[model samples]
Target: MKNLLVSLADLPAFEEIIDVRTPLEFADDHIPGAINAPVLSNEERVIVGTLYKQDPFAATKLGAGLVAKNIGAHLASTFKDKPQNWRPLIYCWRGGKRSGSMATWLNLIGWKAWQLEGGYKAYRGQVLQLLETLPAASRFIVLAGHTGCGKTRLLHALAQNGAQTLDLEGLARHRGSVLGSFPATSQPSQKSFDSQLTRQLARFDPARPVFVEAESKRVGQIQLPASLMLAIRAADCILVQARFEDRIRFLCDDYASLFDYPANFKTRLSRLVETHGKVVLAHWNGLIDEGKKAELFAELISKHYDPAYKRSSQSNYLRLSDARPLLIDPSGDLNACARQLIVDFAA
Candidate 1:
């Protein structure tokens, strides 16, 4: 078998990267494009690990059988159509026996399979280290605005127009607000978020301006990497604006999915009680009870979010007031907005 040991730095050169860790481990984080071909499943790994405490050699024999069966299943199903010359890089936690087995198998089958030297933990270190230094020389153009300005959508629009854009909220799977959540899905673990950020930043050219939406330090459970946040805070900033009516309509539609959970929505509003006062809070709650979503949303934008955003952005951002006029197209013509944003930022 010609399987050679490699490091995380050589990952991109491989055609397919396999994470032979358990499904739960892979779900937590793996190489960006890596497919999971776990040697032991979550339950199976737990069983084997528990058994190991009692009898090490017995555990090995049991693990060997389980690994063999899982590897065979992977070969027959995922690798059934893979050619003899197919090249793959396989890894598991700490570059252990799990990856070694699959790497040997693929190499024996006449394919060029490389085993990662230190596996997922080493790769994670590389990802963290990369985040500490990269997008290294790139200039960032931040789109800062009030709530309901469709900043995230504009970032996507910029991407669609071939401008380099990084959707921070999208990466975190959050909208970076009390009301922002993707009901059925939870945010990735912090490590996973960092890995995802590292992967994207690695792809951008440092010479060009990378567009990103302005956000606070925390987005749901994932905090922005310190280096990345530092870069964003120091980057050139742009003011993204839309008419009040437009913003309301956009927010209503964008967050329409959230309206389904009334109790949760009320709870989110309740958090603002200290700042807005108890009377205002009661009024808002009463609106919710009466299903006066439109009035409630409008009052929230006019009284709560707009004022809060104005103070926060003015104090925190260097260019909020001095920024160029940028009226967002409220009709959801993000494609046009993106084109304009690229041109404006470049200017």
Candidate 2:
């Protein structure tokens, strides 16, 4: 039993990883790549907790029975096909009885199962710590550009072509602007975002530069890691230049869903009232009502986004003055551009 425990570093040694916390706990967060085989249902957990406060002995008896029943259900379903030589790592919130009971049951049934030390809580601590240190040690290549220059598209292209790229906007599910929210998606909680960022960082090769877009402290409501933001500001930069007309077209296509729901689009535009003033807001809203998406996008870039980019890029990105210009074709051949960028930076 003493040898049946592993730390985070020992993760890759296991053939399978199981999260035995309640469903709600697993939904909140869990170890990356771990499968949920909860030892108690959400309601069962609540019931046991309430009973525990009143009678510890009764709670233990009830919890043990519940855990046994759940584990048996998992065996007859979730684990029924497992081979006898299966090696699994199991965890809960704190390597508590939930995980222990599961591990014990599996071991008794002749499967090799180890418990994760200090469970998800300990793993989360390491994730937070790594978020602080990893970005500081990384070399980032910041992609700087005005709105609708296909920075995100280029990021995807670079990724497909095998460049080490981090799409912060994709992770946050927001585009980093007042009107940046995805049409029907929501951003992850901060804790979940940290887990995602940390997972991406773990996959990076330190010897190569990571390609990321120039962003403010926040991407919509998601705050980037301070160290990463600092690293991006100080790192080498590439200015992605696109024709104004092409940009308007690109934004229209990229944000087509918002235009599909004009009322939603106008509501999003209203968020900029305080920043761009009512006169500008009213004009933008009028464009939405008039169904002039191209014209609306054009005005937005020239009036709002371009000016903001000029002001912020000059101040926020320390190396923008010396940034190398990557001219994307008017046809928007991002794959070709990505290939060139790979040779330029990731090489």
Candidate 3:
């Protein structure tokens, strides 16, 4: 009997499996429960690719020999101690040679091993299809406000407070602004972003409202899936308002590290100026050049950010006044605010 590919929905029935893709590929994205047992290490795959380009026939023979030797060693070391009933699911890039060879070897050794029909590529296609369709299935509750109003912070708080929430910028590893990219963190590839979103949405109850921060179609280098953008537009809106000075202080604190690099700081500010215009931009630019970050932040609020909020407020019916002095400061206590909002809304 030949091994067959199985759907993720059917994964619960499978007891053991080995992924035959490279570690980097597996780390970037994979089925939730699959474990890595790569048939080709990253370096070895590079070598094979170079060989294939240089001499296809020689490369094919060498690659096959190397793969067979590796599979033999893997079976001896890992499967030798397994019970006779042990079964393994194997998959590679597209359910091609790598996974096929492994499955064939395992089956010949008296173990039932299967290959995913289309491999990881198929699973990724499923995720992309789901994302393309999710807007119609899910309801959104948008949290909108000026910069540093802590909308992202509030999303986390709401999640803790028992309200369903999706942190789009968080998943994107971006803050959704010109200075959004932090040096220490990196955003996932667009393919991986879809996978992560699909995984996250699977846990949410569609009937309940999911709170998500308002964002443009693009978040840093990644774009929001169209279906998700539609859901965001359809959902009710909540605007968080804060005093200009408070917003300035919040932004300064939120991006304190970026100020250390003046050249990069000027570039980010220049981009914002380009978006907003020159004369008005000059005012903030001068402040940055003078090391008046707090003043510049306050000016950005009064000049650019506040007007944008007013326009959006006019367009949406749902608005929440977050400008009121936090009795307990929701900036640090997001969970408390989320819980309170849930209870208040639930009531």
Candidate 4:
């Protein structure tokens, strides 16, 4: 049984990785490539847990019965197509009873199965540790710009042209600002965000510059790893300069969906009342009511976003004052702008 255990360092050797934790546990975070095959489901885990507090033996008996049933179903359904020679790595929360049961059953069934030594908990520890150190190790080029300077577009273009790029906003699923939320889309949990960031960092070559957006400490509901924030703050910066009119057009194009949902857009903008005052919020909301999107966007950029950006960029980014200016005409070829950026920083 001891010989059946594998460490995180052995991850890539396994062809398949299965997580046996509850679905809720898996959703919060899991190994990058691992698939969820819970021995106890979200609701069932709670039942077992509540029963355990009253009687350990009864809880164990009930859990065992459920685990056995679940594993049998997985065998017939999920693992039905696997050949006898198929090998897989499986884990649970703590690499204890849950994973042990699955591994024992799979091995008995003639398919070689390995249990992750410390389970998802241990994998999470490794992810946290790597996030703490990896960002500092990478050569980061922070792309700094005001609200709608096409930073995200340029980041995508850079990636298309074979440059190493980290799109933090993409990972967080939020634009890192007020009104940055995607329509009907929620951001990942903090742990999930960290796991995603760690996996992306592992793929990047430290010697080559990794271009990333200069986001603040938080992106939507997900807070960035402290080390990553520090690295971005200390990194060399590229200040994107875009025409104000172009920025308005660019934002309208980028956030067109928000315009269609005027009520949602106004609701998002309402969050700025604390910082921008009630009068300002009312005026902005009125613009939405009056269908003056372009004018409202201009006011938001000039009166709100730009001033806030100036202050934060000056104070937070250590190298912002000396950052190389990259003028972008949002109406023009963005891919060309991205290519120019790569050439400019390829030293």
Candidate 5:
């Protein structure tokens, strides 16, 4: 505890980051690669707080005992295999007693452990402050297309080839459409989304343009940070062009899991009734009933997605007018297309 304090700026140099906050706090938002080893659990924290409000000295005695027991467990299990020279960065809420106690104990045990100076609060603040100007620093290349155009796939492909790509929907955990929900997977809280995105965005080189798929303000329930949204809207565009049939085929493959949860899919479709009207809904529902999803998908694209995309892109994006077309060939090789895009736009 003497001189064992570190700043958020030094986080990346450390091999391991340990979050000593409660499980819920860690789950809500944490440093991207941090491991959670809570010194005081959620229930224990509440109990200690209540006791301190009631009787300060007695609460300190009980909290000390609990902290010792928990640290023992962590040393025995979590830190059992650590070598003497293993360097770890530890943090808790507000860089208070919790993290201090853990760091002190680990240091006493001969491991080079340092407590985060302002803990998770400081880290969270750094993320917010970093985001304020970070989005403006990097240039963006928007992958613009209608539904089922495989923009996300191509984004990942670009990433695989070492081109900077931000998979927005991947971070949001939704596909950015009416039927965007993934099978049995729940999206993270907004704070968690922000943490992941801030970390992901920071990893990209500011000197290079980042590739990202076009999306609205919200991906499912997760909202994009305002600055990031503005940057994307103002960026250069790469219109991902494929045949209508190719898109439909992509949709069928991409969304095959939706059929497994037929009721959920139908419920999602129902939300669109106000826009498409009852007659169209009835016909689409009938198609679902008759098990003719390909026809339904094709109809939805032609009737719904195409027109909507054209209108929105024309109004919101400045670069769409002179958009460089990145073709999805007959082979449907998105990786090849992504490589070509990187090559074509290597400015």
Candidate 6:
């Protein structure tokens, strides 16, 4: 019998594999390296689902017939003239009907096709297991600081300076806050997050230090795997500090469009109030409403971000303070900082 369950370690060797699930299902999560060539389009899947709920026998027969016709046409157009040596792995939700049907069809047409044993679900389980086992040998350096302290920007700079860096927020498409979601940018599903992280990590040497931003257990809707969290906690820290005014300026420019929208501004402010108590919130809100964004930021820094930062900083093994806060002065370049850091660590 041919192998069905291929490890991610084995995926690099196989170049052609088709994910035969609905696009929405594929988007939610999928095996790393599998390209989605969904057997049923989103609309067709919905129609079949409705029929399955209403008339099981009729839906099964009709769905199978339609699926067969669609797959035949797809193979004819896409795989025609291909030799018998052509091989492609196929998978659906559970490696049951959909992938089985497709694999059988490909085999009948003289192609070497195999279906994943448990399909996407099995792949997901494997990913979770790998994540659970990942901490045993990984080394990390967490980029930690208060909100708007330019930690994410600094990570990019460090990457440019030849540090192995994982841009978690960038991968998740989230800024790791209630107000972090940008317009038209949705966070990836947990599955996609794992896939993206795995791919990025594969490029780095585990024996070397990898830099990552300090994050809570969750980044937006997605949660970090437990093993990854353990790795983060065990990692060394490089704390970045900046002046309050600079942080506020960075926040304003970073979210200029959101600040420009009165409704969005109020909504985000309200969320802050809900998080930080009404009395403290009222003061900040009054300052914002009075068009004193600077004052508002000062109050928030003094009341919320600073206190949190102070507590977190006490846990850090290393800290860097820029007298001429880089957030305000673009001249306080990260290149020099990253170089100094690497040399200091090396020494």
- Looking at candidate 4, the ten consecutive residues that score lowest on lDDT are 329-338
What do the candidate models score in CA lDDT, each in turn? Answer: 0.84, 0.89, 0.76, 0.89, 0.87, 0.74
Superposed on all Cα atoms, model 6 deviates from the true structure by an RMSD in Å of: 3.8
Question: Per-residue lDDT of 1-347 in model 2, one digit per residue for the tens?
Answer: 54288899999888789999988888778887899999999999999999999999999999999999999999999999998889999999999888898998899889889999999999999998999898976789999999998788888999999899999999999999988998789898888889999989988888888999999999988889888888899999999888888899888888888868988888888877888898888888888878899999998998889888877789899999999987766665778888887887754
> What is the Cα-based lDDT of residue 13 in candidate 5?
94
Better of 4 and 5 by lDDT: 4
Per-candidate count of clashing residue pairs (backbone under 3 Å): 0, 0, 1, 0, 0, 0
Residue 341's lDDT in candidate 1? 71
How far residue 68's Cα lies from its native spot in candidate 1, in Å, is 2.4
Q: Residue 196: error of model 4 in Å?
A: 1.0
Off by over 4 Å in 3: 15-17, 50-56, 72-85, 276-291, 303-337, 344-347
lDDT of 2: 0.89
Cα lDDT of model 4 by residue, 189-229, tens digit? 99998999998998988778999999988888898888998
Model 3 TM-score? 0.82
**TM-score per candidate, in order?**
0.88, 0.91, 0.82, 0.96, 0.89, 0.84
**Where is model 3 poorest over a 10-residue stretch in terms of lDDT?**
319-328
Clashing pairs in 6: none
Ranking by TM-score: 4, 2, 5, 1, 6, 3
Query: For model 1, what is the alpha-carbon lDDT of residue 235?
Result: 73
Give the poorly placed runs of model 4, Cα more than 4 Å off: 1-3
**Model 5 lDDT tens row, 1-347:** 48388898898799899999999999999988899999889999899999999999999999989999999999999999998899999999899888888988988888889889998899888888877778888889999988887787788889998799889888888998888877789999998988888878878888777999888989999988889989989999988888889888888888888777667778889998889999998888878777776898999999888888877877888788889877776576767777877887776
Q: For model 1, how does the per-residue alpha-carbon lDDT over 1-347 read when each residue is reduced to its tens digit?
A: 44699987687799899999999999999888889889899999999999999999999999999999999999899999998789899999999799999999888888889999999999888888898899555688888888887777778888999899888888899988878877788999888999888878888877678998888889988888778878887777778888888888878887776667778888887888889999998898888777766787789899988888877776666656676657788655779878877776663
> 3 or 5, which is superior by lDDT?
5
Model 1: lDDT of residue 118: 91
